[model samples]
Target: MTRSVALLAVLAVALLTALSSIFIVDERQKALVLQFGRVVDVKEDPGLAFKLPLIQEVVYYDDRILSRDLDPIEVTPLDDRRLVVDAFARYRIADVNQFRQATGAAGDQSIAVAGRRLDSILRSQTREILGSVSSNDILSSDRAALMLRIRNGAIRDAEALGLEVIDVRLKRTDLPRENLDATFARMRAEREREATDERARGQEAAQRIRAQADRTVVELTSDARRDAEIIRGEADANRNAIFAEAYGADAEFFQFYRSLAAYRASLLEGNSTMVISPDSEFFNYLKSDLGTQ
Candidate 1:
């Protein structure tokens, strides 16, 4: 019985030692072997990894890329325009040993510390670089170039933290709430001024066109009146010439025709009245005999 118990105890001890000596590293993870609070080995491959039981411990970190969204920070540009900028970054632990040394911690704590450091770097760099340029540049097509500069600057600064900053992006940029109202008011005023100027110019052009049209109309009316008067004068002169020619051709016949015309004019209206003697020159044709007079 004593010999059997001793063998079973040995088997139990072996099982515990074997279990404690092995660790797993997944395809997406990396492992660090720390002995007595000091990093001794780094396991970057997948599958089972070995370490001394009860003396060395394993710490795993994700090898995949990680993302962090930073808080919005306010910055002022060279034009003295205030803007709130929200940014984010994509990073990964490139060197596990360096990362561990840099953070002086392991696991989640190290990641958190590194993230905070990167956040600080990004905020400071964003402020400095963006603040140096004018607000118009920030709002213009040059924004892409400015963001690239910020990203590059951040990548350089983030290297010390063992972080590979793959990409840095600006998520949002806007004017502060305090300035929005004032900005809108100023813009409205500018538009109003422009509209007023446009209206003034339009009215001036309209007036000039109207004056030209009026002048043209007056000239047309004057020409029409002058032509009508000239035509009337010519017609009158032709009638007078016909009358003189008829009188010269036959004096008696002309006098008779003129007296007949006068009688028709005076008697055409039923209410018309004329006072004259029957023997007067106006009625001589009516009083005399036509064949012998």
Candidate 2:
């Protein structure tokens, strides 16, 4: 009975040792087998891996790419203008051994520790590259080039920490809250001033056109009136010449016509007040029908 109990204890101990020696690694994980606090082997493959029963241990780490969203950081440009920039980074652990050494992950991989360090590197590069140019450059479409520069600059430092920086992107860039109101007001005023100047120029052009038209009208009227007066004077001179020719042609008939006109004037309808001699020359035409023509 004592031998039977001893045999059962030996079998149990062997089973426990075999169970502890075997470990399964998943497809998404890369593992490091450590012996007495030091790495003895690296198992980047999936499936069962064997290690010494009570002397070795297995540590797992994620082998996929990772991303971190960084907080907004303030930077000043060469133009002495302050701007706020928000950014994000993509990275991957390319060398697990170097990563473990750099991060001191001998026992376990702390994502927080790696992330904080990466965040610092990204912020530093962002500030350095962005500060080299003016604020206008940061706000313009040249931003893609600027972001590429920041990513390139960060690659070197991140590699020291066993991280490969895939890309660095600027999420948003903007002016501070204290400057928005002043900038907007200045822009509004400039637009209004331009509008006012345009209106004034238009009004001045219209006035000039109106004045020219008025002057042309006045000149036309003056010319027409002068021409009419000249025509009237010519007509009066022609009439006087015709009358002088007629008077010189026959003095007797002209005098006879004048005497008849004078008689008609003296003998009126409501006023006949001529007191003259009966043998006067004024009555020659009426005194005898055809006096002595």
Number of the top TM-score candidate: 1
Candidate 2 residue 95 Cα shift, in angstroms, is 2.0
Estimate the Cα RMSD of every predicted model relative to the unseen true structure.
2.9, 7.0
lDDT of 1 by residue, 192-223 (tens): 99999999999999999999999999999999
**TM-score (all chains, Cα) for each model:** 0.85, 0.69
Clashes of each: 0, 0
Please, what are the lDDT tens digits per residue for candidate 2 over residues 50-90? Answer: 99999998888877778889999999999988898999988
Segments of candidate 1 deviating more than 4 angstroms = 1-13, 101-106, 276-279, 289-293
In candidate 1, what residue range of length 10 has the lowest lDDT sum? 284-293
